[model samples]
Target: MTWPLQRLTAPDPATYSPRQQAIHDQIASGPRGGVRGPLAVWLHRPELAARAQDLGRYCRYDSSLDQRLSELAILVTGRVFGSEYEWQIHKGHALKAGLEPAIIEAIRCNRRPDFADVETEVVHDVAFAAHRTRDLDDALYARAREVLGEQRLVDLVGLLGYYTLISLTINIFRVPPLDGGAAELSDV
Candidate 1:
């Protein structure tokens, strides 16, 4: 299937306004190593880019949930939104963080993944439910709270919320995956 032309490409760095240059440099210097994808698209609004990237840094790096759990939540968010760029970007991170490959595939195909522990399962459940329903019902919320504890649960929700914004940006702008390959999310 063909994708629509990307609505916004990164502005030429040499032509960047001072504000853009500053934000671009900051983003490039951070853990992301470089700016591309949704972050790049956001560079058009330097203030938005700067603020969002700061939140993104916290969500991606310093959240209370460990890398494995964070990546799991990110994958679920990407899949639920059918954000191809988001999915392809984080699939590698999820694997490197030690989430099972089968679980990743299951999420891509919209199937129930068999998680090995209650923590993983609870994180998945919270992400899936929150995305599908737009709000958590009482029991699942209680379960997630109980399983993830207060701080982790809060961070999990914040992480999910952050990725949701990322997904929206990717989808709205028709952002293609960075790999520039055929789309990987079939059932999404």
Candidate 2:
């Protein structure tokens, strides 16, 4: 499939403003190791980059949800937005976080994955519902709260919100996957 050329370019490090350089340095030194994709695009506004990256670091690294479950929610957000960059980047993360490959494939293909546990199922359902409806029904809310607990439930929502911001940035900026890979998601 034909992909649009990226609409924005990250500033060269040599050209970065003092603030930009600081944020870039901080991001590169952290678990993310570098600024790329949407984060790179955000460098155009260093304040946004700094603030968003801080929140992103929390969502990705310090969230109360387990990594596997967090990845599940991120994948759901990526799929919902048809953000190939987001999907391609997080697919590896999902796998590394021990999310089942079959479930990842199912999400990629827009199929319902047969989750092996209730918590996984609840995470998937909450992610799906959060994107599709933007609000949870009473039953799902109660189930999520019960299974995920209050802190995790809140963190899960924050993770979903952060990834949604990511997806929008990637899509709006026409960010390409690493190495200009083929699209991982097609209309389903």
Evaluated at residue 31, the lDDT of candidate 2 is 97
Candidate 2 structure quality by residue, lDDT tens digits, 1-188: 77798889898888999999999999999999888999999999999999999999999999888899999999999999999989999999999999999999999999999988999999999999999999999999999999989999999999999999999999888998988888889755
lDDT of each: 0.92, 0.93
How far residue 5's Cα lies from its native spot in candidate 2, in Å, is 1.3
- TM-score, structure 1 vs. true: 0.96
RMSD of each: 1.1, 1.0
Query: Candidate 1 on 15-124: residue-level lDDT in tens?
Result: 89999999999999999999999999999889999999999999999989999999999999999899988888899999999999999999998999998899999999
Please give each candidate's TM-score. Answer: 0.96, 0.97
Compute the lDDT for candidate 1. Answer: 0.92
Candidate 1: Cα lDDT at 86:
87
**Worst lDDT window (10 residues) for model 1?**
179-188
Off by over 4 Å in 1: none
Predicted structure with the largest lDDT when compared to the true one: 2
Q: Clashes in each model (backbone N, CA, C under 3 Å)?
A: 0, 0
Lowest lDDT block of 10, candidate 2: 179-188
